[model samples]
Target: MAAIAQERYEDSYLYRLRHSAAHLMAQALTELYPGIKLAIGPPIENGFYYDVDSPVVIREEDLAKIEARMKELSKLDQRIVRMEAPDREAAKKLILEETTLGQGPEVAEYKLLLLEAVPDGETISFYDQQRTDREGKFHRFLDLCRGPHVDSTKEIKHFKLMNLAGAYWRGDAKNKQLTRIYGTAFETKEELETHLHNLEEARKRDHRILGRELGLFMFSPRVGPGLPLWLPKGAVLRDTMVTFLKEEQLKRGYEPVVTPSIASIKLYEKSGHIIAYRDKMFPFMEDEERETYILKPMNCPFHIEIYASQMRSYRDLPVRYAEFGTVHRYEQSGEVTGILRARGFTQDDAHLFVTKDQLIDEFIGVVDLMKTVLDKLGLKDFRARVGTKDPLSDKYVGHDENWVAATEAIEKACQTMGVDYFVSPGDAAFYGPKLDLIIKDALGRDWQMGTVQVDYNLPERFELEYIGEDSKPHRPIMIHRAPFGSLERMIGLLTEQYAGAFPLWLAPVQIAILPIADRHAEYAAELKVRFRDEFKLRVHLDDRRETLGKKIRDTQMQKVPYMVIIGDRDIEQGTVGVRSREEGDLGAMSLDAFIERVKSEL
Candidate 1:
């Protein structure tokens, strides 16, 4: 489904329009600021951006200037034309001349480098926007790029420069930094306005802001970047999710296992992760004997070692080991975004060892489990994606036959479950194919959460075997599953999904007992204790000396599901004032009635 969406997007006129708009923005930048060496510009998921080494520092205020120039240039109705170069030399000449304008060869620095980086014998192309202004003056802007852009500049009408950020050339930190200008374009004025409005809503629901406001989690620069400190409420939330998943796994006959944070490098080397995941792995550590160890970037290698600890028979064919394992990777400082893309995170990881005959059924079970998790989270807008290995890539492990079988098994399971999915080549893990749940949030943004991968390579790499019905040894296929890809990522998404007002069952504090006055504090405390002991509910007693209205407002801001208020009248009547986050005030209710309400919410 993700692939289809991508294909439709790439094939859409909006894509061409956006791509041309990027070039238009680049043109405006070149006109407004001389000696701006242009880097690559491409249309991305939600918009397009152009990276350039500007002689003058470009700030947020500069976006408006460039955007205004783009608007004026777009009104000129320049004809867009595609041109091809016969050889690398000709391409270099085009970059030094036509693209250089009056800035000389120094300004063509990145363009020349881009041309040289193009593989030998590959077709070289450029896009040229040309038109005669009303004053009969001819104006044109030429850029070195593979072209399928809009036919004219007039098509890039509705666009806005979003912001500016620093981007390293080709995403390499060692390379020179460039200014990246982000912007979005739409097919119609109304659509553009709607998109801008949605951006506003998304800002209001931004997880980083809400994560702190709701007190679910906190990050301290004193510790480090991307390593979050789970506060009391946040810890409870994590425990709630873990406990629920553990119970579900228990019902499904999965055995719980634990692994360490760091492991000997030999383990990953044997599983082929050391090579395939070298870039993401933290720096290797050396022991006295020259033995290498490193922080684990994945849990699969450790689980594989456990599976190989003892010989197995067909009767014990499908062995499922589950763990809420924490792993660390060296994410670039700029790429790390709060907990969503944290360097240290926990994966609700599990590995299933099964025979060839059991592959389809095992895959079906994994998919069903993933679906159950998504459903429980109240995430209905999602699509299944089968990520298969790229045929042209040699970096992938395993034989072609194994890759084909694993891909087919995942597809078959989706078919059996009647779940719609699309195949996305080149997205598979290095060792196997995977099924990803791409969730669409309230703001129409897609997030790739929860993944189930079918692997025939890892077992083969480790030579994991079991005795079959024929009394012969056979390699067992492995299923790598993480219904919540990572607790941090899932919680981040959920925080934004509910806007921090979590469901009653998942909320850190399900109920709050607020005393209307200092005199009523005693009754409120009693009700809180009773609620906790009887229902095992996460209840809090707000016995503060503040005014009743202030306490109620504070509880509401905390997003507690329900609040029980005890005042003189309530204590005298043997009742409590019940107020719900969503339903406002429900007046006075007996303690028994409130318990039923909480139970119903659960």
Candidate 2:
């Protein structure tokens, strides 16, 4: 976790404030709805939420009444206290008697089940809120929970009840559905206001909305959820990215190879992915020959098969294979958030097989390539994370010595690159340790954009070998890397980062030529051809017979990087009125001069 996020979780009082806020909301809901049964309430990222089962439906408008009631309750200065029970029976009694609030033992159904799930030796704790009113009437609210709550409810003043949704109990589909109320609390009013404002801006900049509006990409109901169909503009964006990365890979001496989209199930079994990554994989397919095949969820296994195709000598020890392979994973429908978390996406995948002696340099080379890619993409605000083996996790499948060596290789690579990174345990791939680049987007949200993993297990699993100079068979280290991660995901991030107004070189339609009148249409058409054929620029010509003003408006809305206006004044002098998306109109310039300007940007 980053420092600010870590502090917010462990050190800052906001966590306690948010936790207390959840309890406060629960108390208000209990008072408002007689038959409501509380399940669990916990503080989450940016806010807190409570899940409850209510006999009466709570509409969106009903939230105001609930918030009003919460405000009235907070001012009561209710003292929040935590109490622990000695045994399971004592916890059940507390839940049945006090936590139910005279609504009956049936209301304590979820809490009782929660208590049963707790281990035998663990302490059963509950939070109680009580206050004495002016009439001297004692009022209290209690819930069966393990909590460290704020001393009083007054501290939860700056908070808002954000929204409500239906969530299954414990996230199990078979479990009964409950009403989930989400809210955020802040120490100061300013912070809460700022968060709300940013949320509004985020909604505007949401990639799904902008993706379609900007004619970049779209999701179809017929195509099913999480499957995106790239439109013309979107395809152009993908091609531009591919061209750039392909050239970079070629420069780095990576051999391009194409692999099948579906492979035999045995491939994954040999790679240990069937056991470790079955959940993320699509359903297996059985062919006529009784062979089980699965859609490719990863490209590494295919690359491995290629490397082991032939016996290799020490001179051929370093084999780099690159592929823009499309992978399909079975992401849950609800979990898929547009292209960001899609069921199918392309990976800028590659694997470098090298001798153990070349591991450090190969790792460093991969890291350097990643840095170069990030720099070109203008994603500078990123942090490196060295994902090491978790001491507690048995999920990792590599030998202890191999894990240690691979982990050390990644850390040393980062050190030699002079890039600071934090060690994150359990973030490693099951096969080995990795270096993940977490980039902060324009919205200040962190996205895992790229990764480079040092793997020893996969090579061993495949029994891959190469002849060393000493004439002995030896194992090779594998450096798996993808600087872009995926075309869909990276494009999604870039769309939001630039608000669809991509930089000049990246813009799908680099320039739009608009003719002022019917007489100038030929000139505009000629210019478009010149820009496309001669200069290799993505250009669009507006000859739709629309008014000049309307044409300019449409062009700007499309977020074209540049515009050339041709009219009688420009036609006679052989000059074009040039306008840039960023600088607006740049007066009039000759065609030769315009070409030079465009060359500077490219």
Candidate 3:
């Protein structure tokens, strides 16, 4: 418990402030609405939120009233004092005594719930905000807390209430619904302002809004909730990303393979995903012979089967198989968000089978590849997460020694590469440990984009082995990696990251040829063919009757990187005026110069 607290303290300063603010928020709510019952108040990433059960429904108008009260208490500069109780009975008696004086039975009930859940030998602590006046000492308001709170409420100077939503108690669907209030807090006003501004920027970059405005993608109620339909323009963007990754993988000795969308359920059972991920998996279907088949939620098992298909030797120690494997998982309705969290998506997945001696070197190679891909995509802000085994849980397979070795291998790889990373225990797959990359977008919001896992359990479970130089059968170590994670998710994040302005190489329409008048249409068409044939550029001829300004606006809205405008002067001069999305018009230039400029960018 001390270790956990130390780790939390090292990772976040906002966490302490948010946790303290939760206690203050609860105190303010109890004062404003006397009969409101409290559920749970926990600190989240950006701030803290408390759940309440009340007879009177909270409307939007009430938020300001509550917030004003919170501000008032914060101004009091009350000292936050932490106290420990002997046991559960003492904790319950304290709450009951407070209720008799004027506090509600709700506090007693909440205290009782906490006492029942706390483990034996664990210290039960509470925090109080004490106040005093010239005449006498004012009373104290307290709440159950396991805290590392600031010394005074003055430390909580920057905060705001964000929103309200209904949440199930304890996150179980069967539990009673509680009104959850969400808010954010920062250490300083500047940080708070920056966070709020980032939120606004994220709203503008929301893929659903951009997708509708740019005609990139769509979701239909008739089709499904988490499934999306890619429009013509979106398809081009998706294909471009896939092709880029494929070319990179090919250059690194990865062989592409295709697999079925659905496989026999028996395959998953063997892979252990059926046992561990049963809740997230879709229902199975039975064929005429009553054999069950399921939509693949992961591509690891299939890739393992492919590796096992051939008898490999020490010479073929590291066999890397790559695929653009599409998978399906059953996400709850509330959990579904745009393309970021989808039911079906394509993963740029690859699995490497290597000898035990080759594990560290192979892992290093994967890290290098990930860096190259992320660099190409302009995702420079990312940190690695070393997901390790859960000691207390039986969810993972493999011997203890193997798990230790795999975790150390990943840690060594990170150290050797000189990258920042954090360890996340119990975050690994049941089979083995992994390295997950968390990336922040332009709005300063984080998203997990890539993962690389080191597995010893799967090879053991599948009995995967290779002949050593001594001609003895030895177990092989498997490295599962995907730089993009998923095509759908990467595209969605990239869309928002770039704010719909993709790079020249990744843009669906690289160049749009706009003719100022009908007389220049022949020249624009001829130029389009030449660009397509010679430069392999995605070029479109705008032959519509719309004016040149309107045509430029339309193509700009589509996020085309370049626009080639041909008019009387350009036709006569054997040159075309070039306009860029990032840079405004570059005066008329020869076709050769235009191609050279674009080639340099690619």
Specify the highest-TM-score model's number: 2
Candidate 3's C-alpha runs over 4 A off are 1-11, 99-123, 172-176, 390-395
lDDT of 2 by residue, 234-263 (tens): 999999999999999899889999999999
Question: What is the descending lDDT order?
Answer: 1, 2, 3
How does each model score on TM-score? 0.92, 0.94, 0.92
Give the runs in model 2 whose Cα sits over 4 Å from its true position.
Answer: 1-12, 134-137, 286-288
TM-score of 1: 0.92
- Give each model's whole-structure lDDT: 0.89, 0.89, 0.86
What's model 1's overall lDDT?
Answer: 0.89
Model 3, residue pairs in steric clash: none
Query: Local error of candidate 3 at 114, Å?
Result: 4.1
How many clashing pairs does model 2 include? 0
Error of 1 at 581 (Å): 1.3
Can you give the lDDT of residue 87 in candidate 1? 88
